[model samples]
Every structure is written in structure tokens, then in C-alpha cells.
Target: MVTPEEIARVPKVLLHDHLDGGVRPETVADIAERTGHQLPVDDPAELGQWFADAATSGSLVRYLETFEHTVGVMQTHDDLVRVARECVEDLADDGVLYAEVRWAPEQHLREGLTLTDTVDAVREGFEQGVAEAARRGKVVHPRQILTAMRHQARSLEIAELAVSYRDRGVVGFDIAGAEAGYPPTRHLDAFEYLHRENAHFTIHAGEAFGLPSIWQAIQWCGADRLGHGVRIIDDVDTSDPDSPRLGRLAAYVRDKRIPLELCPSSNVQTGAAPSIAEHPIGTLAALGFRVTINTDNRLMSQTSMSREMSLLVDAFGYDLDDLRWFTVNAMKSSFLPFDERLALIQDAIKPGYAI
Candidate 1:
């Protein structure tokens, strides 16, 4: 049995966390007050509950509405630095050794700051957080994934921003927002540019929408990984856990070894899955899909990597080996350089999981 404390002690890798979505409740309250924004609740605990409740409305749009308050407070450069720094501190406290945090820089320009300013601010915060964690005898490595809003026309610009910051802390680019009407094809120019630049990128597909969204993301936009690809299970036939059948799409994904960034709790909150026990991640993992568990929005989901892993242990009887397998999968699928990933796996991950 893997105790919660043991799980926390195990070095973890996160590939699909959102910067805006994981802001701490107290930080949100502080920023709200500082920025003169109104929150539904002033108390940190109540504000946290309000976000969790609002996200559970079972609509992707409704789930995203909760970000308005968080993002509203996150307009200033100081705010961005603070949030990014705390993001690292919080993840380090939870024993996350590496994480790729994604957020749309375009969204943070409302306070008269340029996209570069916001990105620089976040980078500064990440560095400060890393130094702070080191002082506390904890180490965390975090990289940024610049996201382009699917409903906006700034994907090409954002893609350029990501490339410009490639030598900095930016590791990848992403397209995020509602997945229904705004397909990945809409941002063909950006994807094509990223492909030409040999830049890594992931697509936000197969979460709110179905096969078409996923199909276009993979076959059309050429995503390195699928974000919240819970809907991929729709194409999988699991009449037998031992020998399940995969549809053409699912088979293609598995055969190609494309990573599926699966967020179980956030999936439930968005009605992607009914509950953790019924999530497709277990079946997909059992079937040898390249699945990586994640907490899409920690604040909204009220979760961490440890909580997510513990929930899986309770639901599916996964042992330490299973947890290690998931952690390695995430590390393998991360946008970090091959050498860094290998170093973390060999030095941190394997040693931590050793009996």
C-alpha cells in the first residue's frame, strides 16, 4: 500500500497543469482586493469552495467562467510574478519535481502590459520560486507553455511569442479554450509555423468535444500530445478489460504512442466523466495507452498530484508500481529536453520508488 505521505515523498512530474487555473485561493483573494475586483466570497476557504462549486456546473463554458475572477486579479506584472512563484512553491511542497505550467499570455494584457512583459514576469517568478524552494531544501523545475485562446485570432502571434521565449523558460505552445466550435484547424497557421520551427506543442482536444475535435488535433494540427483526452475513450470498446478493442482513432493514438493528458477530477467537474472510479484513464492505462494523469485546474478541482494519485489508488487498487508507471509516463511525455527527462527519471524517480 502506498501511503499518502509516501506518495508525497515520491518525485512526481506534471505535464498539463494550468497557471491561471491553479492560483491559490488566498492569493486570489489578495489579488482581488488589490486589483479592486469583486469576488463571490472574500474568505479564502469560501472562495475556494465557490470555485469548486462553479466548476462543477457540468458545462465547459461554465467551468471556465470561474477563471474570470482569477484572471481579473492577475493583470499586473507583480500579480503574475506572485502567482507563478506561488505555483512553484505549492507544487514543490506537494513533492512535484517537474511541471509544465500553461497559460495564455494574451489574456494577461488587460493591465497595459505587453505579452513579453507578462511572460517575463512569470519567468522571473518561476526563478524566484525555484530559489525559494531551494532555500527550504526542496527543488522544483517548472517550464511555461504559452497557450493561444482557441476562440481568438492571436494564435499565430502567440506561437511566435512561444518561439521567441524558447531560449527562456517557455518549452511549448498550446491552443486552449472551448473545444466545440473552435477546432484546431482554425489555428492552422500557428500549428504550421510551430511544425516548421520544430517546436513542441499540445492541443486541447477530446475534453469537452468528441472524436472530431481529437481527429483534427492529431491528423490536422499535429499536436505532440492531447490535452484532457478523456473523450478518446468514446472511441474505445472495453467490453473486456483483458482484451479491449480500440477504434481506428484510439488504435492510431496507442500505436503512435501519443500521450493523453488525462485529468480525472477536472474531468468529473466538467462532466467529462461521472466520477474518478468511472474514468476512462484506468481502462486506458490498463490497455497500455500512453496516458499521463494530471490536475488540470488544481484550485477548481481541489486536487494535487498526490490527491489525484491517491484517488486512483482507492478507485482502481493501483499500487506503488502503478503510481511509478504513471509518473514515468508523465516525465517521458513532458516537453523538457530528452537529457533532462532522462536525468530526472534515473536520478529522482527510480530512486524515490525503490523499495
Candidate 2:
């Protein structure tokens, strides 16, 4: 059995981490205190547990409500920088070699910062964090994924913003929010624009909803990846475990090598799955689907890349090889350039796992 410490030492790549969702509770309290914002609790530790507890309510809507406090405190440029920097440092400490940290810039405009300003601040923070981590003998490469709220109508603008910042720290674009009423086709124009620009993007689908949402994301929106695609298991008929049948959509996803960004803990917290042991990742991985592990929301789920991997280790009897497979899957699925991705796989990830 691989211990948690051993898992922490492995090189990992994260694809679906949210910037605001992973804010440090202490930082939230500090920013709140400085900016005269009210928090549910004053103690950082308690506030942290409060987020976890509130998100554990087993509804995606309720789980997302916890972001209000984190987003509330991140309206300022310095606060955004701090949160972004801390996110990088924390991931570095957990041995994440590459991560695409995503957040909706529209959500941070309450404090008078323009969309471009928010992106610049976050880029500055990432650069600082990278330098600091290197000083500590840990190398981490963090990229930005600009997300537009699907419930809102700013996807086209966000897509433009992502394309504008592509040469900068930003690597891709995405849309996130409650998935039921707001279909991905609502943002079809943005996806079309992204495709025209030859830019990469992902869509949040098959999490709170079902196959229809996944179909819309892939067929209608042409998402390069599916965020929280835990619900794709709905298309897999596992009645005969020995010969599980993949429906058309499931077969297409597997045949096309579509990457499923699966967050086991977050899926359970959102009632998408019963528990880690029962998560669709086990079946999906066994079926040879391109499944990558992630910490969807670190603070809300109270998890890290290491914790997620460890949970899988316990639930699926996954050892270093399994963990390496997940890590490689994530790296291969990342929006990073081809040469850079290959270099990391050859130099960093493989060497770390071989240890």
C-alpha cells in the first residue's frame, strides 16, 4: 500500500482546480477583516471546516454557495494575487508539477478591477510563486484557464479574453456554474469563436446533469475536455460487470480519447457519486477511458492532489503504477504545448514515479 506521504512525493498534474474555490481560509478571513467583509466565522480553522461541511450538503447548488465567501474576499488585485500565489505554493508543497488554475474574471470585478487587471494580477502572482517554489527546490508550472459563468452571458467575452492572454500565463478557456438550466449550447458562440481562433477550451458538464449535458458539451460546444464529467458513467451499462456495455456517447468519448477530469471527493460531496469507493473512476479507469484525477475544490473538499490520489489508492488498490497512469493521463490531457508536455512526462513525472 502506498502511504499518503509517498503519494505526496509523486509528481502530479492537475487540470480542473478552481482559483477561488481553493483559497486559504486564513487568507479569506484576513482579506475580509481588511476589507470590512463579514465572514460566517472568525477563526480560520473553523471557517475551513464550515466550508467543507456546507459543501457536503450533497447538492451542486449548495456546494457552489460556499464560493460566495471566497469570491467575496478576492475582489481586490492584491487579494487575487495573494490567493493565486498561495494556491501555487500549496500545490508545489503537495508536489503538483503542472496545474491549470481556473476562475471567472467576471466574478472579481466587484472591486473596480477590470478583466485585464485581474488576469495581470493573477499572472504576477503565479510568476512570484513559481520563483519562490524554485527557491525552495520545488519546480511547479502553473497556467491560467479563464472561466466564464455559464449562467451569465459573458462566455464570448471570456473566450476573447482567454485568446488575448494565450501568449501570457493563460492557456485555455472554460465555462462553469450550475449546469441544469444553463446548457452549454447557450455558450455556443463562444465555443465557435474559440475554435476559430484555434484556442482550446473545456466545458463543465455531466456533473450536476446527465448525458444530455455531456452531449451538448461535446457535440454542440466542441469542448476540448469535460470538467467534472463524473456523470458520463450514466452512459455505461455495467449490469454485466464482466462485459460492461458502453452506450454510443460513452463509446464515442472513449473512442475519441476524450479526457474526463474526475474529482472523486468533490463528486461525492455534490451527490454525483456515493463515495470514493463507489466513484465511477474505478470503472472508467478499468474500461480504459482517459480518466485524470483532480482536486476540484481543495478547500471545499478539504483535499489535495495527494489526498485525491491516496483516496483512490485505498478505494481501488491503486499503487504507484496506477497513480502514474492517472498523472500521465492528466499531463497528456493538459493544454500545455506538445513539446513541454512531452518534456515533463519524460523528465519529471517518469523520474519521480520510478523512485
* Candidate 1 structure quality by residue, lDDT tens digits, 15-34: 99999999999999998887
- lDDT, residue 164, model 2: 99
- lDDT: worst 10-residue window of model 1: 236-245
Candidate 2 minimal-lDDT segment of 10 residues: 1-10
lDDT of each: 0.94, 0.95
Q: On a 0 to 100 scale, what is the lDDT of residue 295 in model 2? A: 96
Off by over 4 Å in 2: none
Error of 2 at 33 (Å): 0.8
Pick the lDDT winner.
2
Positional deviation of residue 127's Cα in model 1 after best superposition, in angstroms:
0.4
What's the TM for model 2? 0.99
Write the residue-wise lDDT of candidate 2 on 215-262 in tens digits: 999999898899989899999999999999999999999999999999
Error of 1 at 98 (Å): 0.5
